[model samples]
Target chain A: MLEKGRISNIQMEFIMVPTIIATGVLSIPSIAGRFARHDMWMTPIIGSVIGFITVFIVWKLHQLYPKMTPIQYSEKILGKVGGKLFSFVIVFFYIHNTGIVIRQYSDFITGNVLKQTPAIIFSITILFVSALAVRGGIEVIARSAVICTTIFMITSLALLLLIKDLELGYMLPLLENGWLPVLKGSFIHNAWFSEFFLLAFIFPFVHHSAKKGLKSGMKTCLYVMLILFYVHFFVLTMLGVSSVNQFYPVYSVVRAIRVFGFFENFEVIITASWVLGNFVKVSVFLYVASLGLAQLFNLSDYRLIVFPLSLLLFLFSFWDIPNVVVLVDYMTKIQPFYFVSVQTVLPLFLLLIALARKKRSDHV
Target chain B: MIGEWSIILLVQVLIWMIVLFEWKNLKKASKANKITFASILILSMILSFAKLEYLPGPITLLHYIFGPWGWFME
Candidate 1:
């Protein structure tokens, strides 16, 4: 088989940044606000536990099997049937997860931007673009993410303009609901932080010679949590408890920007960058799903399945998500456990199995 | 209703065009790949035309299975 591709630690780090941050910056602030209220900013400290554990686990798994994805290496640790079953389940999970990601993107865009353009179009079009990017493979996606992250960061300058609205007093009532709700708020981002498992699919492709990948990956996860923490802080300080009523709090914050009564509607600028970041996010998940499918089926070329997988994704997303009300409900109530089970606990289980087996292939 | 059907027809045409353009390479796909490809393509086409009535949402599925276990998924 031809070498799939390789990406430097920096590119991997860049990819991780948007993949982790894109969802939280859009969806989490409001959800976190609902639970933690003024203490929402404090949730990231607990969120960091998820980030550290996930990245650390994936990194250890990668160290154990240097040249193989979890899909490929599971067969080595467990015998054929068990490994194949594990890979099959996780591959399907990745595919299903990608569908939900696209659904979120479709919901956000259709609800906020297009308004009337039926979500089918956005879902299909974005999935098509992501499929095209995935066809170019990981190097292309990583490089594209680098460019998008640069734009994404620049657009976040809108956050700076929001500083005038900051009120420290808004956070004065912190812990008004006690520490319990703050911990509950952490559960939302905890799932997001464990999404580092998505990177395990690409970990073998990472240029980790200098051990820079682990540091960079951890930093990337830290960056996402910190950014989410800051965004939550920013939103809380500006909108206070009112932010919890918003579907997209960061966008609401950006929409609130009015410098000297001249600069307004800066949200569009942030949306464009955010939408671009989402493209990378969806493409990465799409790539993982397609690549996993191809590998699972023993196909010669992953690209052959990208189109079909993407089409199926659109169909599944449209049929499955129905509306944002249900979507958000699922995210808060159900997705955290679902994600943690597949992304964190399952991988940890595999690691423990490999350890008990005492495989000679492992390296620290 | 005609407009919606026409939209579906146009999208199907566009999908086929891309498939045709990529067919030179896709022709090398194995029987399993071809069958899987064809099945997914047909599924999407059928879904495009379906009225979306009575389709259970993803959460509904999760809720149904997990609800009995006290996992309502809200």
Candidate 2:
């Protein structure tokens, strides 16, 4: 095993939830609002169906292999060359995806809260912190996740302060366009939800039965759905359709919170908490990329590559993305399909082939 | 010009620090491990000297494959 660490189902939940919700909450509401309008709150509810399906697929695949990650199992299921090709694609997809994720994090910080600071500085700092966590192994990431995710959940409660300012009328005229628009809104969300496939990398190291992992994975999906629904509800009610105009709708709505007519400027607290959440997000992806590369190349240890790969990730974040506008454009249009194809569709094929191969071997 | 040079210098410093820290492990590691580490490090160093924003990258490749489909969202 490349990783000797064993994590419980609960630790798995802690790591996985923030991995999805950390980035989803910041950008999704506005993107959903673009299509669903008053019906935007339903987007997460619809989108989480993909999360559930992805968790089941990952779980089923893990059940078949039981002792191997997708990197190892792909070689078992496909011929060695085909499997290596597939593994290379999966690993490269994640490396590229992680770069975009780091870019999104830095963009949020530099474009919004720390306008004077250079964006690369924020990326490097977060990548450096995450590199330390990745080097410590999965137990360290999960343990830190428990603390960071808790702070993220608590700070997110500040959104409740905006209850008085909500115009419930904005949510009326429900389905203003129709179910088609709501489906369109959920399309982008399915991309985020499909990230549930990341659990496959962690599942082999999980110390529980596959059943328990499945249950926790489903529960995490529910928790994410509710959290996203809660954020979208607030953003839609407080900002209405204007939420679509703001890049960071959750940040915008949080900025509008005025507690007891005295306490304001709470966006900074939310941003700080979000940093904690993104810390977990980036670390997990960094760890997966390093581990995946090690497994792909038959390296003795993943730790040696963490720093160098981070430098590559740094280069990737700045690669041809000139600004947040292009970043958001990529997310809305290309990312959904790109993420789904590699993470979801590819795994589905792997599962089907593995199942067929198993039945044949049984008959033989 | 100064800012760009400083950024390059900072990257070089970071690279050396990583190499120095991992030198002991690298000395005793397998040939595959050394080659992969050195290759990735060299790739990053070369890219760091160039303007990354102007470089054709994965995003550009993905855009070429999926750019036409992006219009469907409109």
Candidate 3:
């Protein structure tokens, strides 16, 4: 398996930070702002708690089984047939999530940047790029993320420059709806946070202690929360209620930056930078899904199946979800529970089972 | 019509080329690996040609299990 490429703790952090922030930076404010209102800034912070929980739980699992991924070690915990079934569940989850992510990117790009262009074009292209990244192996993906991190920093700075356009008054009337709405607003953000589970697929590939892994993940989660807080604050202040009504709130906020009325429409550059993050996101999930499939069948190499998997991803990207509206509804309503359950609750259970097994073995 | 077929054919050819390129390695892979590779390729190719209408997708599943979730967007 290409000698199981290894990335350092820092490269893993670089890989994860942009991976989590990419979609949230441009997408979360609008969705979270729907319920959050003036308190939208708080969602990411509260949401980060879920991220921390996910990191810790997955870290515990990693500590228990250092040599294998959750996919590979589930057999030890669940026993043969059950393990393969669980592995398929994890694989299918990632596959389905990757498809939805590609579709989300496709919808945003086709809806905003390339109007009249088919969403499939964006989907296929991004999948192709992600496939290339996946084929290059995790080390390659991590190194590429090192470069993309620069683009991400520049984009963040550009967003910071938009503060002059923000109307701080729009953030007034905080807690008008009490903490309930803020808590509700964090539901979707928690779903994003729950994505920290993907690190389980990645954690085994890194040579680090579980404590350091959790530290890196926690730090990334905190930084992502800060960035998401800024995004929500920026959009809510710049566009106010108009931000909630817009599909791409952060993109709209970026659009509002009119430097001297000539240096305008930075959405293209922001999106170009955003693509690097999306590439890492898709590549990571694709790599893990293929890895799971390979292990499920005991294949010698995961890269052998990347192409066919992309085909599945392309097809699934347009799966039963139909339009973006329904996609948004599903994501808002069902995805939070579904993702948290599958990504966190399942692993938490698996960890318990693994611990029990360990105790039983020690006794025996 | 013809254009759709062309697109589907193009995707199939592309997938086959990749699989075949790696077939040397896959040739020695387990029976499960070969079956998995073939099954996904064929399944995706078939789905790509199928009508999108026929696929009710996750929305319907969510609607059935979770119940009329479209209101959340409002």
Candidate 4:
């Protein structure tokens, strides 16, 4: 095996939670609100249903191939040529997704915190940091996640302070436009939630039993859903349907917090938490992409490709995503279907083929 | 323009630094590993010299394939 380090189930949860929510919390509410309006809080609950199904599918795949990642097993399930082609597509999907994730992070920093600095600097710095973590392997990523996620969750709690300013009446007449808008809003989130399929890469390295890892994965999805719901609740109640107008509704709500009419400017706390969250997020994606590539070509080690892949990711962040307008447009329009198909739908197909093949072999 | 040239230069400098830092490990690495490393590095370096923002990259390609589905949100 290319990866020798093993992580416990809880550490896996810590890493995966930030991986999904790090970017989702900032960007999702506004996008969902654009469709769901006052019913935006319902979007994440609906979206997380995909998370549950993805977790079940990934677990079944893991049970069938106890010692392999999706990259390795896809080769066994398909013929050599077909498996190589499919694995390449999967690796490229992650490479592009990770690039976009970095773009999204740098966009937030430039658009919000550091307007004076060029965005590429933030992208380079974060990718460099994440590259170092990826070089250290999954255990290092897991350990840093434990610290980063704790800080992220605590700072996330600061959003609760906005409850006082929220107009409870804003959430009334829920589902007034019916479920179609809410379901439309949930579409983008399903893309994010289906990211649970990333667990396939980590499953072979997890130290605990498959059942425990499965439970933790489900709990992590619930935690992500609740966190999104909480952020949406604040954004919806405070800004109402107007939250859809702001690019970063969660950041706006965080900026509105005041404890004694004098204390405020909590945006820094949330930004710091986002930076920490993005750190773990990028590291996990980088690790998965590099590991998948190593497995694809039958390399002796994945660590060798980490820095080169990071540079490729840097190049990708600049690949036609010139500004926030283009980035958000891509996220809303193309990404939901693109990400869901590659991450969720493809895996479902692979699982079916693998299961059918297994039945044939057993009968023989 | 100086800005564009500088970006290209910066990318080269960054690539060189990575190669330099990993030279020891690269020396010990197998032929396949070395080839993979050099190929990805060269590809990114070549890509960095181009006007990437103008390039019809993966996003544009994905838009072509999945662009129709976007109407659901519209």
Candidate 5:
């Protein structure tokens, strides 16, 4: 077992913001457009409420068990068997989630950039590299996140360079459909925001004062929300409501970049930045999955599980869903519930139970 | 196109190098643990080559069963 090290609040914040912001930024404008129509920018602001609620639940849980991971405290809250079962479900979900993320990334690359390369090849390559990072443990992962996130932020801003091509008319008639679309968009946004549930697994590992930890995590969530808002807004302005018709509006917007002739096809740069960002994101999930597995089974070494688990993930990525449409449908309609239930609802339930038990015992 | 055989060979050599590096670092890891790790690496290589087409019907069914969670995409 690797010793848990001191990670300042800021470092903890940096670690999470990029992980949440990764591939999601590319898909949001398109996804939000599906429900929010021309009002996609409002989706993120509304969705952030869900993100804030999730952070509060996690913070509350952390408050009860100051330095313990959810995995560590589950047994105490639910009794040993129940806690283990809960931990098992979470571990299972994260492992499956990691594989899908890996698949999504490989599919993206193969579909767009490396057309001739087999997707399994790309998937295995990424899994292999990510496995190496996971083995290095959390500190290395956090440090790399800081570095990659800086680059991600810069490339994200570069999207703004396309402002000359944006049409403000595309954003006209604000809320023309009233609040229905925005509310629906908020549901999708809530699903993405629920990703902050990962902080439950990581917060116990941070070697910061509780107050500082809470502040850093909230700050990180705020930063990511800002980035997501800007990315979705720009994509809508650049491509119009028709942008929703495309699968990856951000990527399309990047492709639309045509400054002075020489700056055409900045999509390559966007792709590079996205790939790196997804790398950190995927690696973090993989790490969480491994850590959860280790804690559940009481394993002494996580490194030993890395290769086999990654191989299983590689295989899982190649399975089922014959084409892209089904994949997109699955992502938009089904994923929100999955993310919100386990990451949001379940954690909130556990936090409430833990708090009540703590209060009862305190009174006694 | 990189020939299928070449990709296989390249992946195998890389796996062998990784095994050698690990072996050097922890000389005392049980032989069984070492063998298990090596076997998994070999299995991954073999699975990598089986091509998407060669997967058996049962395996494909199993794949679908575990694949596709609704919350993954949009």
Candidate 6:
């Protein structure tokens, strides 16, 4: 069981920021560009607005039951049966999601950094390491995030060394398609932005004195969003909108960075930072799945399930997708709603019900 | 994508073994709890396999019900 004294608000902020930023930073610019074209930078701002509304909804629910997770409050709002069913849905979703995320990071590493290496090796290695962290529980994961976030920030600053190659003309003719495309792209990005809903699971577990945890969380999310926008803007300005068509523009940008000839090939550093971020992201999801499973069974311990669940996740990561294209298609087309609903909508619904029930109980 | 079928099968068996090891505690679970757990497991299994096929028939049905909410990227 995770003890209540384990993590503080600052630690929680560290955990949430890197996990949300890591994978999205790599792929979002290109994905958003697919819809928004030259206007990709605006999508994050619009997405942030939508994201904050969703966060407000989640925060309102937390205010209703300041010390209960969605799982605990669901049972309070709905009866045991309904709540368990809802929790089961959420847990299963996390399991599937965790597998896909693990696969994504593995595929990315193998595709860019270790082209000759079999992706399954990377997949299993990452899952193995993450499973160990999950077993150590959320406190270890948060501390790991703090260290990884510092490293990530340092690597992000390294991109500044490439400013000489940047071309401001790439971001010109702003909103060539008008604001409509930007708004449409925001909806796609909104799904990505709503990932902060994971905070709902960890909120009740934070040490109570961690003042303004939600505010810190939202601020961290906005900071990450700002960083993402700036990174994408820098990549666009450096590589141009046409060059951004490549699958991993950020990696390409890193490869393009050449300082004094001796400082070239910075993709290695970006990949290393990304690997750490992916570790935190995967471990958080895996921990959530394990915790949800433990609660579903009313078990006293979640550690027993960690290794077994990770083994299953490793298998599921390679289950049937034969290539990267299929994986990308599934991620962009089919899976966004799965990511959004269980993580965002269902929690909001549970929060509303919990709030109403709290009011009713207080009236009595 | 390169894992041997045997490895995949072995991992699945290991998961079942762990679940079975925990089954004694599950015995005390209410009927509703059992139903929910079973449904979740079954649904996740179905979706996992559906990804193997090109279309993922059940997910398509879900997408259809959700009704063309910007997934097409047009």
TM-score for candidate 2, residues paired by index: 0.98
Compose the digit string of candidate 5's lDDT tens values, residues A133-174: 888888888888888877877877778778788788888899
For residue A262, model 3's alpha carbon misses the true position, in angstroms, by 3.2
Candidate 4 lDDT by residue in tens digits, A153-258: 8988887777678798998897899999999999979989999999999989998637686888899899999988988988899888888998998888888899
Candidate 2: the clashing residue pairs are none
TM-score of chain B of each: 0.65, 0.89, 0.70, 0.92, 0.57, 0.49
Q: Which stretches of candidate 1 lie over 4 Å from their true place?
A: A359-364, B1-11, B49-54, B65-74
Note the Cα lDDT for every prediction shown. 0.80, 0.90, 0.81, 0.90, 0.75, 0.73
What are the per-candidate TM-scores when only chain A is compared? Answer: 0.96, 0.99, 0.96, 0.98, 0.97, 0.94
Q: How well does candidate 6 match the true structure in TM-score terms?
A: 0.87
Cα lDDT, model 5, residue A222: 87
Candidate 2's displacement at residue A300, Å, is: 0.6
> For model 4, what is the alpha-carbon lDDT of residue A253?
85
Q: Write the per-residue lDDT of candidate 5 for residues B3-64, one digit (tens) a residue.
A: 26765676567676666656654366555455555665776677557553344532344335
Q: Give the per-residue lDDT of model 1 (tens digit) for A140-191.
A: 9998999999899888867887787799898987589898888888888887
Question: Interface RMSD in Å per candidate, to 1 decimal?
Answer: 3.4, 1.8, 3.2, 1.6, 6.4, 5.7
User: Which regions of candidate 5 are displaced past 4 Å?
Assistant: B1-74
- Tell me each candidate's RMSD, in Å, in order: 2.8, 1.3, 2.3, 1.2, 4.2, 4.0
Error of 4 at A63 (Å): 0.5
Fnat per predicted structure, each in turn: 0.39, 0.71, 0.54, 0.81, 0.13, 0.14
Better of 2 and 3 by lDDT: 2
Let me know the DockQ for model 2.
Answer: 0.67
Candidate numbers, best DockQ first, in rank order: 4, 2, 3, 1, 6, 5
lDDT of 4 at A21: 94
User: Which candidate order results from sorting by TM-score in descending order?
Assistant: 4, 2, 3, 1, 6, 5
Going through the candidates in order, their DockQ values are: 0.42, 0.67, 0.49, 0.74, 0.17, 0.20
